[model samples]
Target: MAKIAINGLGRIGRSILRLLTTTEAGEGFEIVALNDIARPELCAYLLKHDSVFGLFPKAVSHDDSGLTIDGTRYPLTDNPDLSQIDLSGVDLVLECTGKSNSREFATRGLRAGASRVLISGPCPTADQTVVLGANDEMLGDQQVISCASCTTNALAPLARAIDTAFGLVSAHMTTIHCYTGSQPTVDAPRGDLVRSRAAALSMVPTTTSAGRLTDLVLPDLAGRIFATSVRVPTASVSAIDMSFQAQSAVSEKQINKMLAALPAPIFGTTTEPLVSSDLRGRPESIVMALPETHVTKSATMARVFGWYDNEWGFSNRMIDLARRMTSM
Candidate 1:
């Protein structure tokens, strides 16, 4: 079995762990190590409190050194330093830390003998930004990969579907994302240069790396996409409101049919109203299209809505991508 390492046991990391535990033995890869800068107790608390998958596998056990799951015991590394871990047997590493998106971390994992690194969040220099249903074929085994943001994964396939059916001229999106670990429950001093003055009390207008990374994943739509984000008070899940200018006339029915025709394993479509809460544990759906609301007032303009379990959905993709990379 191939060995895997996860960095940053936060929202996405914990969710990924849950996915690995629930998947069938062969489909689920082995977790060799989990690292976080915070105390080990935090990771323990998360594993114990997981609502969707419940507790981790009984075969799994952890101590101060590390935890063992499915006959694989991953020792806990003292620090988040990538170079410190014994990567001699690690086949892949998943970096979920929302820290600066740098290739250096992934590079370190590779140098430590890891076959490949899959970054959960946006990286400053990602060789490829993959949206599972949209452009997973773009992933190559020779380089490190970034899964982009959860919102991007939700929006990319929708955008690509429209662009493929009827050429996309320009697109804009406003992602109503849930509050993350990076945000404080109460107002506190911000750290990064751009987010320093922002507050959690109100929706803050912030740029999203999604649109920029989306272009990389689907280069055909490059320069035609832009996005902004507003952090809401929710704990998990997020919504995306997207508008596109099509090159030709297209009705809601036409777009709905296209989305409905998508394979079940990758895309999900529903006639009933879809809410963020409804998508909580839906692992296979990278994007859910709201058929009722999709519309086009003119030959060039169309609108769509999508909901995503940002952590679970994106983490599942990261795991799948990691497995594919290992197979090569």
Candidate 2:
């Protein structure tokens, strides 16, 4: 069987393993090795009990030998120098540590001996950036690739689908996002005062690269799409509040129909009054809150809500892009 390696056993790295080992979507790839700055036991502990996903429904243990989940042991390494870690048979390395978002670090991942590298976050200097179902056809013979940010994964598909169904004239999006591992629990230095506040206590407004990166994925909406983000006191799912001005007028019914008609896996529509936590384990890239769909009185502008389990869905997308890269 083909093999893979996880360079950082962070939220994304662990989620990738879960997608490959725990679920029905558990794919053909086997994670043969792991690299992280933390100890294997700590990594195992976090993997076994995710605050966001709940307890992993599988036997989990770790030792100097390796980290085992569901009775399958994967060799674990904690070398601070990633290139020093062996990835001999690793077809691809998932660069999820979030520490290395630069070309220099991405190249270091490739140096670990994998045929290719798939970054879980944006790496503009990466050979190519892709969001599956949107612009994956643009994937070429690139050694290092990025899946972009979670916000891009959640927004790009809707952009592509809406742009295809009805011409997108201009769009302004605000991602009502959840706090990630990056934010500190209490007020501390985070390179900015706004983001330095307590993560669980307040909503912190911040910038997002989703629009610029989305433009890279689908050039048609290059300068027309704009986005911002606000980190709320949540741990699992995130949402995008988008107002898209179409080329022509359209009703809320038409907008809802367009969303409902989207491909189920990439874009989903739900009529239920679901909150953020309700979407905690959803695998779809973006789920339209059907009842919340709104259109301007003039019908030229439509407002919609999209929810996504940032970590879970993005991890799934990593698997999808990884499978595609390995196939090539």
The lDDT for every candidate, in the order shown, is 0.74, 0.87
- Tens digits of per-residue lDDT, candidate 1, 1-328, equal 7788888887787778767765652364768778887766566666767655456654555677776566666666658677766678788888777663666766777776677788887876767777787897887765678878888888788788888888889988989887776666565677654344334466666678788878877888898988999877566677788888888888887887787787755577667766667777676545556564555566578887777777877777777777777888
Weakest ten-residue segment in model 2 by summed lDDT: 22-31
Instruction: Please identify model 1 stretches exceeding 4 Å from their true place.
Output: 25-28, 51-61, 68-73, 191-201
C-alpha lDDT (0 to 100) for residue 53 of candidate 2? 84
Model 2 residue 316 distance off true place after TM-score fit, in angstroms:
0.9
Give the best candidate by TM-score: 2
User: Clashes in each model (backbone N, CA, C under 3 Å)?
Assistant: 2, 0
lDDT (Cα, tens digit) per residue for candidate 2, span 1-328:
5678888888888898877888765567777888888888898899899888888889999998589887788888888777887776678888988866677888776787778888989897888889987897889889989899889998998998888988999999999999987789999998878998999999999988898899999997899899999999998899999999999988899888888988867787789998888898788899899999898788899999989999988888888788888888
Error of 1 at 136 (Å): 2.6
| CA error at residue 12 for candidate 1, angstroms | 1.4
- In model 2, state the lDDT of residue 41: 82
RMSD of 2: 1.2
